[model samples]
Target chain A: MQTEQITETQKENKKQSTWRTAVSALLIFIAVPATIYLGWKFADRQHYIVSLLIILYSMVPFFLMYEKRKPQARELVVIAVMCAIAVVSRAAFIWAPHFKPMTAIVMITGIAFGATAGFLTGAVSGFVSNFIFGQGVWTPWQMFAAGIAGFLAGILMHKGILKKKRLHLCIFGGLTVMLIVGPLLDTSALFTMASGISWESARLIYLSGLPVNAIHATATVLTLFFFSKPMLEKLDRIKLKYGMMGD
Target chain B: MDDAFSGYHPAVNFIFFIGAIVFGMFFTHSAFLCASVFTSMLYYLLLMGRKGIKLLCTMLMLFFALSFINPLLNTQGDTVLFTYIGERPFTLEALMYGFVTGGMFVSVLLWFACYNCIMTSDKFIYLFGWCIPTISLLLSMVLRMVPNFKVKIMTIAGARKCVGKAPVNGDKKEKLQNSMDMLSVLTSWALEGAVVTADSMRSRGYGSGKQSNFSIYRPSVRDMAAGIIMLFCIVLTIICAALGGMEVAYFPVFILPEANIITILGVIGYTAFLLLPSIIHIWEEATWNILRSRI
Candidate 1:
């Protein structure tokens, strides 16, 4: 049965490969130059193009997770739930300015599910939570920031960097999430929302973000330290019993 | 409340959102940025009344703090304001740049709140549905799921409070345990609902074949007209930007571009775009008031 399922998925993948290659070629040869031309035509069009590209490129992973895997209904539901949980966890810590549990949740989702699932969780949560926090030009930046953390987490898990040792995971998760959310998000703000300041002044803001980034890192570590083990164990058992994706 | 802007086709609202966000962030000219800020404040007051004013005050405080911090850390410009430590010069250029940057930030931030008021989730789903249906389905579900999770958590907390296990009334350790218990309960509850959703979706043939979109928004003649107006405004704004009519160079020295006729025309077009919803709102309110008084 497993072999049959694998073959079916492989056939589906083969069928789509032609169009996939065509789309990528179009992006490379035509779409990219066109975007650049439009960007050069305007004064501050580069940031919008860059952000729109991140989301559009993220489609590769989105396809890998859904179309390639042909994830079962149950797995899709689980991924969506993980996204909801991550968003609510961020709100759960709303009183704390820089302490964000959503990063830890994204890390756990990536570690437990896979990188694709992790990226989706982070991106979805970032996008959804802005409804409460208010959506702006920074919404895409937040999505990219959180999504990178999850994508990195998946790489860590695949490479056995996340194996057994909880301390290593905490340290790595803290630093990566903070770096992405702090410096990256800060710079995006400078470029997209507040480019009146010089690049040097922008760098100053990034440097000053260190303290808050440290707090964010600490929150990731503490949340994961307390909660990740049980969640991972549960996910493992679910995979074993139900043959879920990433099993 | 049934707002006037929300009554438009979702595409129209989305176009306006794109216009406002792009134009608000794109132009760095002091007059343009100030106009954006002023319009944002006006819309915010119309949207959230006193709460919006409070946010405006907060943004002002942040602006001054950022301005002060900029000259202290970044001594890059020519016109020195004051010197800190031994040699670092607080330049007038840096200060003005900081002020303008702060204005840009506040304007974008207020526009976001304004977006929240105008572009409801239904509107968002309607916008994305045609292009990426599955993703929009997931997004709309997520929109529903977030508020549902909050309400469910509150219910769980209320139930726990009755049992003397609520996080609110307990000592340190107990409160910690209660919060954990609440999280775990929420996790389980979510998992249960997810499974049910999965089954229902499967039974209903979620991924069977190409499915048509179920959109509640339709493009009226008014939407078409409004779309053309927005497109014209955007084209005008872009031409103005490309012509360097809205230039405000602040690197070596703070400078405001000359507000010539072309720049003034661009400003009018852009202001009209940003305040389109507000205009619709005022028109609706005035007509309603007139009708009521006649009655």
Candidate 2:
């Protein structure tokens, strides 16, 4: 009789789960059409809003999972701030033309903090800084490209490529990223902005990006190799002082 | 970042999901100019209400600085600002165009920031997962992969340091060697992890002939009603856009025949309609909580 009761409970749970799945399916069906329709409507208006919406939308699934995987507020704030700083610093190089230095800072941030932080920093910086010059559909890709640079660096650190003293290797990797991934990102942006097939335009954009990319990589390598461990240690001390880092 | 992935209002997520697609379709045209200006101001107001407006201000300042400086450096415009040492052109037109473009760019970014602040990532998955399980799963895996990859990097770096060859600040050759080593380790681990995941998923019949099922949070009747209204708004907006009722152009002189009085009203009406779901849901929840408190 007890075994039968347990089986009955199981059946009830299955029924409930099935109901949940059906509702979820219906919501998805509604969402896709709405997205496409909205896209068609907003097309040729404020391109930035679209980008803003996507970045914001990307946050939704994570938010839904928050209760099961709670994130610390302090961590989010730090990541946001770090990203803001990284992007702004890169923008500053537009005047001074320093590529290596900025990249190093980005790399260090990623290596020490982790990929999400790197992504946040890269994305936030790109988006925020771009707003000053002009905004369009290209912003997300710019954010993705720059942020991914830091993200990849962080991943390398995870795999043991970046270390406390491996300055040269980190620098080499940073340069390789510029030559390879950097141009491709710029190309994609140009392609999206207009169907301009001009090699000249592509070359111009790529050339313009070179200095900034170099600065970013060089700065990232230097900071990652030298200051990261110490700075991270200092951050830990600050956390301890403020009672921010949770056990 | 405890809240890095939490507290997304469903209403906000829905707004953004539709909003992004709109941006994707219309970014190249001149109407984007007007939309950029209008939305920038709206975004500023939205941020101000949230008491998080300083971020927008900071970003705007940067935009101004970049627009002005970019022209000076590039020296490629027609209406020259001043002759430099090489007689390089710095057109007033380019600077002005850049400024408008820059403003548009920043406004969009601020919009995204606002979105990020309000909407968490999980809602994105829940909204998309039911219809597109394969893509949703891939996204989920990517998110999880980030932290996992970080852990592995730290572990390997520590292990290498112990074995001595800790070339953090080495010559170019040493740096090259270390990078390659790191890549090799990362690639192997990633491949292994992918294989394991595939095997595990197959065991559970993830991609078998049988249709898969997912358990998710249930939407109330109110949620369904809200969803319907949003869909209606989306359709209306598309019609408005397609009919050219929303188009705006500038630089042959900024004009928007699409922004006729009737079309403007329609746009406003549809937007309100889209927002009805959120307003209703919030009101219902408040009433329920209040009654529960009284009891």
Give the candidate number with the greatest TM-score.
1
- TM-score, chain B, model 1, is 0.90
Across A1-247, the per-residue lDDT of candidate 2 in tens digits comes to 8888767756754664565555545445665456556755655433334444544444333223321222343444344434434433332222223433334545556666666555555655565555444444566666666666667766776788666556544665567456754674666544433222355546766877787566655555654555455545544454565444243
lDDT of 1 by residue, B118-206 (tens): 89877887777654555666677788788888888889888988999776666755654566566667877887788889889989987
Chain B TM, every candidate: 0.90, 0.63
lDDT of 1: 0.74
The residue ranges of model 2 lying beyond 4 angstroms of the native Cα positions read A1-183, A188-204, A212-247, B1-15, B20-54, B65-100, B115-121, B130-132, B167-172, B186-198, B209-214, B247-249, B255-259, B270-295
Docking class of 2: incorrect
Q: Per-residue error at B38 for model 2, in Å?
A: 6.1
DockQ, every prediction = 0.40, 0.06
Error of 1 at B109 (Å): 1.1
Please report how far candidate 2 places residue B67 from its true position, in Å.
5.8
Query: What's the C-alpha lDDT at position A211 in model 2?
Result: 74
Interface RMSD of each: 3.5, 13.9
Query: Which tens-of-lDDT digit does each residue in A1-247 have in candidate 1?
Result: 8888768856755766555666656766777677667665654435544555554554444543444455677788888888888788654443346657888888888888888888778888888888878787777778877887888898788988667468877887777866676777777656654334566757766777777778778888877877677667766766676677845
Q: Per-residue error at B182 for model 1, in Å?
A: 3.1
iRMS, candidate 1, in Å: value is 3.5
